[model samples]
Target: MKRIVCLLLFCALSSALPVYSLTFAPAEETAAAVADFERGQQLFHSGSKERALATLRTSVQRDPGHPKANQAYTLIGRIFIEQKRYPDALLYLERIPAVMRSPEADLLRGYCLVQTGDFAGGQAQLLPLLGQSFSVQDTELLLLALTDAAVNLQQPLNALFFIQKALPLAENQASLLERAHRLLQGHLSDIELEEAAFMWQGTAIGQDARLQLARRALGQQQQQKATHLLQMVLASDVTFPYWQEAEMLLQRSSMDSWFNRDSIGVLLPLSGRYASYGELVKRGLELAVREHNRTRLPVRLVYRDTAVEGVSTSQLVSSLTDDAKVMAIVGPLLGAGAEEAATRAQLEMVPLISLSQRAGLPQRGDFVFRDSLTAEQQIQSLVRYAIDTQHISFSVLRPENRLGEEMTRLFVDEVRRFGGEIVDIVSYPEEGTDFRKQIQSLLWEDYVVDIPPKPELPEFDEFGLPIEKKEEDKKEPEELEYPLAPFHALFMPDYAERISVIAPQLKFYGIKDVTLLGINGWNAPELVERAGRFLDQAVFVDGFFSASSQPEVQRFVELYRQAYEEEPTILSAQAFDAANMLLLGMDDATVRNRDDLRQRLAALRGFRGVSGTVGFDAMGEAIKQPYLLGVKRRRIVEIN
Candidate 1:
């Protein structure tokens, strides 16, 4: 009923609503009214609007349509609006030319239109008034008018736009955001979030918008995007109320709910047997954080040594998992350590980006991801090269260990897939030194002994007469030469210690000219010292080659050497790339929690990284391209 009455009143009086900003007569035409106009302006400025209105009436009567009269009409219209005399205000305001309309008068007429329920019309009237200067009270009223029109018209997003503008001016930002969130929850599109980011850029609200956007990226498993979005949070003031959580998300970048945590766990064997390896990875982590902390990004790094105080790997990982403040975990170089942390990470739904690889470590859940090379990937590359080189028959020789067993499966799959055959597959104990027995079984070790001696035959002279055979030589049995094994190549997935013994034994056993293929474990330069000339022409695949001449690779090597005074090994290179990958990938994924970061890392493909092209296979493990290295004259050279 009240609404009906308001509607009737709107129909009766709305026609008189202002079409403001009309052109007025020039000041020369207002000369006759100058005295009254001056008095009216003085009275208005002195807070005597009632006296000013009477004086302004005299000015308009003397010089009709004068600019001074238009100003008088605007003041009178505003007065009538305050007094709730809507039709009277609109009658005075309508005479004003559009060009002559003051911001104050437009707001007043816009308010009248909305109060009378002509929301769209009122919004249209105020649209032009935006981007104009107004007092605090006037700005608040204008915002209220925009909000009302937007809500009544069912344009919620438009209302949000106005609310965002007023957020900085609001008395309680949290309350405003809470209310706004209810209205906006699922209505905002990705593009709208981005637009809000731009609209609120350089303000706290902008950061919040970016956080929202980062959540989307992380949800899609785009790590770098998340990192980029959260980087801004780190660059902000640590004193911010949300700084601790932002820092946590930046460090680990778990989820939006987890973004408020402030610490990230770095679990490495920093104090004991693997300290050197830990140092290499730590250097990469430091460099990554140093480059990003120019803005004092709020994340706090908590380094936990896996070998600390005799703590076991599982114990350390479990303790970190229990640390409510630790939002993400990014270490544990040992495969066992990563595996130990994997289950707890999944259960907690936190993210764990391990720098080591173990079967089923990250495969069980989206909570864990690896950026380190594995035996499967290394063996796949080596087998592919062997097949490509036309070596159709291959002998697989490896240590009797888990890695060897796993690598054997991968090698056999690829070799047979490419129309090749596994001529022989042999395994020796990892601690074995004498592999002659093993090599002999695969080669021509017994070929000389297998055949009985034959009589030496006489050579014929040029004259066609048979020359006499030497009596002693004819009685002596002829020694026979043996051909190598039936296989054209050998795929050895063992490291230098074992390969050195095995490689030479194969050659000593009369196996020559056989293509020798190896996995990343053969990349150590010491293999030349151990295997000596036997390593010649041997080709192997490796996760990283510090000596690579790629511009990016060269720069990393120089920087790493300069910073640490040592040549970087594959471990250091992979660790560096891992750290850098997390940092850069997060930018693309934006700032979410660690679980989202795990997904992002898993979804990565062909991301050009320092270690290799960092990507993930279907099982959520690193699909890094290992370099094919050939030993030529005891020197390492990259093979195509």
Candidate 2:
């Protein structure tokens, strides 16, 4: 019965035909062929590819019409494909007659055709199966092959269609969407494009089609037509993927309608988990605006709270750009919300300086800029300082958590790049207080304590009788080893709360004369208040230090204290710098609209702000050195 089942599976045919067909063969010959086929399958699974192919071929030659013959052919073809022997795979796959060919066989053949550059043949083989029900994986393969074929043949419409079909199965959806937009733009006629726009309605591809049409209208000097098309997109869906481009087009069509050069939009989470952060950033932006207005031609500040229910960053950005017509935007302080706002600002073609610490926010577009200090920036500054100070060898005693792992990885990579070696690495739980074991692991063999000799036992008597014993020799107790620390430095990528507890433990273990490295989290007052004696001379990095003697920082801090009557945090300082950069750029008479403001901000260099000397690189990331700080006399102070 097992042999019969194996034979039936071997002869299973195409989707349109019965899997098994009635055939007569001598029992012995059929059994031998089946045995060969099973052995070949086992050999293939065991990685003996050449032997498996030889076995499968021998089975096919044994009984050409046996049910196992077709199975052998299929396995042989699959092996060829695996070996990248495309022509061999094609040869075997073509031998299976079309009427008996399984969907799997057709897929294999299509793959071979594509690999061999016979794209048209591949399309012919795979396109028919698109209508048939197949496994998700097989469907993905078909669409990928078709996409490749169409792209090779310069058939943009077909390639776009295949990509749209593959989107649900694609892991890299963003890449496919981007490729789809590129394919549709300037690749199709008006009528064909209109069909696609209608087909993919409410999608990025569809919105891009309308954008292309608007571009055509503008090129032909049809201002009203272009404006109407772009307005249609914005009116229907503010969440439309390409709405920003549409808004920009509409603004270009009628500059007077949405070009308030004197207005700057502010998007912040003023009511939620991040409300406090929003308030800090708002205070700084407000201070900078007031100071800017006093010097320049008063620019109006328009504020929007992102935490409003039923209102998204998309709608807020639309309101700011389309209605308030702000020349540029300041922030959405949190990561997720900041990314959304940046995407909208990008599409709207308004310059936005985001204060969120999210990585790659600026890559959204040319208009998006990030002014916040990031984990990478902090680590870079700390590692650079360590290398500069000749701290050659290091050890890491980090918390067993995500931030700890990330910072440790960054530190190790940077040290390796600077030709320094990491002597030891260990982690302690964030919730733990006893770090003695973890700290002990970082110490060298010289630090090991000596074991005292066992106390001398009394002399035993022979034959159950006590023997006279001389007085035992006296020995002093073994002393503990207190060796000098081996590593030049130790990096603890955790908060000050944990550092205070960990510092004394290091001292208890005789770990001294080693430079302690830290992230921004160590810049707290409690760090000094709790462990000042242990952490004296410890260095850390941060975007802002209120006690700094820099004139710009002093002025900003004084103004912030006077207005809010509270100490400003890094959030406030970064926002102030971002807003001031925008406001200062707006002061230029040539900056008449958002485009001009974007150019001015992108080209900004060496503008001193409270945070640091603010500038922008080509990717719109802030170019500034974070402030290096250290504990001096138990006080956190800016260090040279």
Which candidate number would show the highest lDDT if scored against the true structure?
Answer: 2
Stretches of model 1 off by over 4 angstroms after superposition? 1-257, 260-264, 294-300, 308-327, 401-403, 444-479, 588-599
Tell me the whole-model lDDT of each prediction, alpha carbons only.
Answer: 0.70, 0.81
- State candidate 1's TM-score: 0.54
Local error of candidate 2 at 382, Å?
A: 0.4
Candidate 1's residue-wise lDDT over 143-188, tens digit each? 8788778867867668777877777677777765644543332335
lDDT, candidate 2, 1-640, per-residue tens = 9999887776663344433334445889788888999999999989999999999888867766677777788889889877666776777787787777888898889988987788988989988888888788778778888988987887877887888889889887877776676555434666767888788777767777777667555534467988987877777752445665777678778744466778889999888887888888888888888888886788878999988989888889989988887878888887778888887777666788988888778777667888988888888888889989999999999888999998998887677655577899988888999988887788865466667678776656667665666557555566756677779999999999999999999999878889999999998989999998898758999999998999999998899999989999988899889888888778888876666677688789989977874798756789888999988788888887
* Clashing pairs in model 2, backbone N/Cα/C closer than 3 A: 244-347
Global lDDT for candidate 1?
Answer: 0.70
